[model samples]
Target: MHEWALVEGVIATAARFAEENGITEVTEVVVVVGELQQVEHEVLEFAFENLKTPLFKNARFVLESQPARFKCRNCGNEWGFTSEGMTEDVSEAIHFVPEMAHVYIKCSECGSPDFEVAEGRGVWLATIKGVKGDE
Candidate 1:
């Protein structure tokens, strides 16, 4: 799954950063996952669990949700994503299947796909604070 690769990349990045900073222990990790990216929370958590010991056994995965932001194609007004608000209207689209629950966000104003994906398109690390001990 792409999520695995993404998660592993994040872990590796964090590990490399910690290593470069001469930090041996990672206390906590906070990350923000955008909704438009459509990452599975359970799988992300499981991936984190499997790699917990390899990096820092006590390191924790903190997943924060970044709501989907839709821009208005007509009036340029933007709105946050909601299940019944934006996704339900596109149920007929194959990408918005009920089983997989995947549906691209459409502009609420002009109903156009010309708008940009601003908020919900990336996984960001919020913070990684810890003490670097000398080995």
Candidate 2:
């Protein structure tokens, strides 16, 4: 599943960061998930449990959700994104390709398709905690 791929990238990035920073034992990793991505937390957590390497054997993987926010270019209106009224297919499409939001979403104020995703678009490795080599 895509969650596996995403976890793989996260583990790799965290490992590289630990190596570069001389962190001998990773303690915790905080991953930020954008609402637009619609990542399944259970699947992601399972992937992390299965995909992490020795460097992260003791690492605690934490996932946080970032609410999607948008800004209307036409009316200058800003609002949050919600899938409440969206069809399953449309929601799934946006989940796989966030940019597709432009095709399916519009400004709640002006009904204009021209809007910007002001926040919550992609995955991010927000924080990493570990024991340095010297420690």
Candidate 3:
């Protein structure tokens, strides 16, 4: 699953951060996931469990979801996105490439496809807690 790839990237980034910061032992990592990615939490958790490096051996992986929000350029109307009414194919398309939102979604107020993804686009390494070497 793509979750595995995502977790690998997260671990690599976190490990790099820990090394750069002289963190000897990582204890926690907070990851923020955007809703538009449509990532499966269970799969992500499993991937994290299987793919973590020695630096993250004891790290508690915390996941948070960020809701998708859009702002209309046409009318300056802002709104949240929900997949409730989308077909599986449409949802899958957006899941793989969130930029497709512009193709499939319209502004709630102005009914214009021209809009901006105000938030909730990709994964982020929100925070990392660890013991510094000199601590």
TM-score of each: 0.74, 0.92, 0.91
Question: What C-alpha lDDT do the candidate models reach, one value each?
Answer: 0.67, 0.91, 0.90
lDDT of 1 by residue, 23-126 (tens): 88888888887775566789888988876655567887888888767665556877765556544445334222322322355566766656655566567888
Better of 2 and 3 by lDDT: 2
Q: How accurate is candidate 2 locally (lDDT)?
A: 0.91
Prediction 3 TM-score vs. true: 0.91
For model 2, the superposed segments whose C-alpha errors exceed 4 Å read none
Better of 2 and 3 by TM-score: 2
Candidate 3: give its CA RMSD in angstroms.
1.7
Candidate 2's displacement at residue 60, Å, is 0.6
What is candidate 3's CA lDDT for residue 82? Answer: 93
Worst 10 residues of 2 by lDDT: 1-10
Residue range 1-135, candidate 2, lDDT tens digits? 157888998999999999999998999999998899988999998998898888888999999999999999999999999999999999989988889999999999899999989899889899999999898
Best by TM-score: 2
Candidate 3 clash figure, as a count: 0
Candidate 1, superposed: residue stretches over 4 Å from native: 82-104
38: Cα error in model 1, Å: 2.0
1-135: candidate 3 lDDT, tens digit per residue: 167888998999999999999998999999998888989989888999999888888999998999989999999999998998999989989887888899999999979999988899878899999999999
- TM-score of model 1 relative to the true fold? 0.74
